[model samples]
Target chain A: MVRNYLYILTGVLFLYACGSCGNKGASGTNGLNDIPDDVVNLGIAEISEEAMQGFVDNMSSPVEMAALIKSLNVGYSNKYLAPTDKIEDYTTNFQQAFSLGVYGLDLGYLNMYNKTNTVLDYISAIKTLADAINVGQFFDFTTLKRLAQNNQNLDSLMYISVHSFNQMDNYLRKTNRSNLSVLIVTGLWLEGNYLATQVYKEAPHPALKERIGEQKIIIEKLMIFLQNFKSDKQFQNLISELSSLQEEYKNVSITIELGEPEAVEKDGMLTFIQHDKSIVNISDETVQRITQKTEDIRNKLIRK
Target chain B: MRPYIKTIFIFALFLALARPAFSQDISELTAQCAASAGDVTYLKDFPAKLDAGTPGGKPPSAKYSMLLSKNTAYRFTICTAPDSEGEAILDLYDMNILIGSTYNKATGKDYPSFDFKCQKTAVYHIFVSFKEGKAGNAVGIMSFVEKL
Candidate 1:
């Protein structure tokens, strides 16, 4: 029954994207003044408190990590991406949702490098998984494919694609489906970190190493989000496994120095300059532990 | 001869056209707003939910809480519904202290976006409300420029 409702909701949502809508004050049961019942019936994601929502809001998108990898100027490498063919093995909603996030970041990585040729493969995989979970409506495939084909407008392509995922994430949470949101976010971060670790192993850069170590802070926040659904068996398994990584992260520490913020007017906009500095300390042993544990967790997620 | 068939067909057509009247395209708003943040490498954005207003009252304000990492430069941009009657204002705050605002309330001028340079890495609030007690559809995008 839920699946049937979701299908209807997807269809209605896709068809309802032309203008502005309100979730209130319909004049009659079938009045034109009201938002369609199927849409309103798409109950908000079951967010119990503002804190959980905060966790979702506060968690960083994989785009930043992917962009950082690109900054390394090492050039694009296919080995860093989650295998595109791995999409089919993820048949369950949990698997599909998680891999959707994994691939979303992969798409970002591809987008950053002007690697337009390969972006479609990841997009195809993302569309498949998104459709399986009934959230494909948020993806504008026709427009996105068009954008992907024209590599000159990489900015437009990246914006549309990322914006679509953000909308899907919002829809899931609004419909009380934070369970899926949790998995998607986890998969995104996991793949991002996985990429970072791989890059660091190949060429040890202080910048990349510091970034990888600083993920300790993000992992703490992610753990809190997962614990929000610990009662679920899958979430429980994730928490237990990730907690080990957290324990390993405990071996690392980050220190910061305060600095003054400078505000300047540029191009008729206010641009503030932050002056704080942070130092991350990670031992060789801790790095190895993190690399091993992260790979293990990711392998389990993909059933590799 | 086919009155009922014609009625059903008309109803379906109305449904198709009427959707925009009742829907706010958050995705498009976010994308457009993000694009407007020129030259700033993209990071992430916070999508705010603006409620439909009551007959005459102001729509409830939307508050987005975020962790603005210290030493990082972030920008907040907004794009209100194309058909909106007024602009929505974005105000930045920390523990009730007014850090900055997109609209100069004193001057009655509005800006589409504003940037923040963080001296402290802590959770801050990005409050969204309509100007002059008015309300309508809008989206606010937060992006990173640099982390110092």
Candidate 2:
């Protein structure tokens, strides 16, 4: 998706870098110093700091999610993942950024299942997307590829990949490219939700069921961010797509009932935990409805 | 042109020589703060820069937002370069609601770390900065203990 944005950037550079030579209204070349700043092509939006922070707290780590699913012993299915061949189809910034995230979660899923053979395809695609987005400096593709090639020590691979992503996320925020950050996180959340709902449909488990319902809250935050950039036609479409999932989740309520709290000191550290339990009251019909919406949105996202 | 080249060459040399020192200072202090946080598994640490020279609403602050799962306990270890002066403070906030802080400035003491027991699996925010709104560098480390 990001490759498409290159054309827009080239157009922008051509308009601005002409240095007034092409700004004579088709009559004659203007002087170097007379270039207008408002010459009709400086359109782009950034993710606000507040919305970026929301994404930071909002996304559950894909690796962690995949790890959970692995622990549950669910069989892996590539059918649920965005195919590697579709990598080149995503040409726009929106498609690239969002699918970068989708593929990221898919990588985690593959890693969790120790599917080493399929991992390189994802790393290459992710690297291409990262380079397109200009955050490729932080993604150590060589190191990561080496780890994947080794494939014996999974923890090291997980740690390195997570670190690479964390650095990218931080660098993006530091440089105020929160739009890309948000898209990446959005992809992660969407794919993670899709995986859970898919797995839950196959095997009904309480934990996974709760996980699906709890996304109602996450989807609500995601909707708010998507709304922030609704000026973009694609974001508007995304908002529309997620709004359906939100509708299914509207009735899913999570209430916290406080339990006994205790404080214990271990190794000179004061550790305290509130024994509070959260009850997610979601209907089975609601879960099915949410599953459908999640699949729809996720499929729409990865369909290209 | 010859003088200009000599000046540029000197400045370049200085930058090359000083770059290591600068990295050493921040990285060493960060490692110190991180090591002091105790036996929990080390997660990723974020760099923080607090400065008085920054413009409005600017302070060297790092905000970490992540899920602190319910029935799970987490410990946040924050180390600042100016901790000797009790300047670095880390605060835990839940969805815009201020929960707690590292140094209860009222007590004039800085705890190297703080623990949080999540009652609900919700997003939690960790805000790191220097006390008194001063300028400095710092790091915050998060880890889970006894996932019961």
Off by over 4 Å in 1: A1-51, A150-152, A276-278, B1-19, B22-28, B41-60, B67-72, B82-86, B94-100, B104-109, B118-123, B146-148
Task: Give each prediction's DockQ, rounded to 2 decimals.
Answer: 0.28, 0.29
lDDT of 2 by residue, A1-304 (tens): 3444455445544544442232121111221122122211111244555656555453656655775666577889887777878777877667777888888889888877878778889989999987766666557788788888887666556655665677667665655555566778889998999899898999887877877877877777777766766666777788888787788888899998866656565775655566657878888899888888888888878855
Error of 2 at B24 (Å): 8.8
Please report the TM-score between candidate 1 and the true structure: 0.79
Q: Per-residue lDDT of B78-132 in model 1, one digit per residue for the tens?
A: 7787766657878887657667777777768678878887765456787787766
Task: In angstroms, give how far residue A177 of model 2 lies from its true place.
Answer: 3.1
Q: Ignoring the other chain, what TM-score does chain B have in each prediction?
A: 0.78, 0.79
Predictions in order: lDDT: 0.71, 0.68
Predicted structure with the largest lDDT when compared to the true one: 1
In the order shown, what is each candidate's alpha-carbon RMSD?
A: 7.8, 9.9
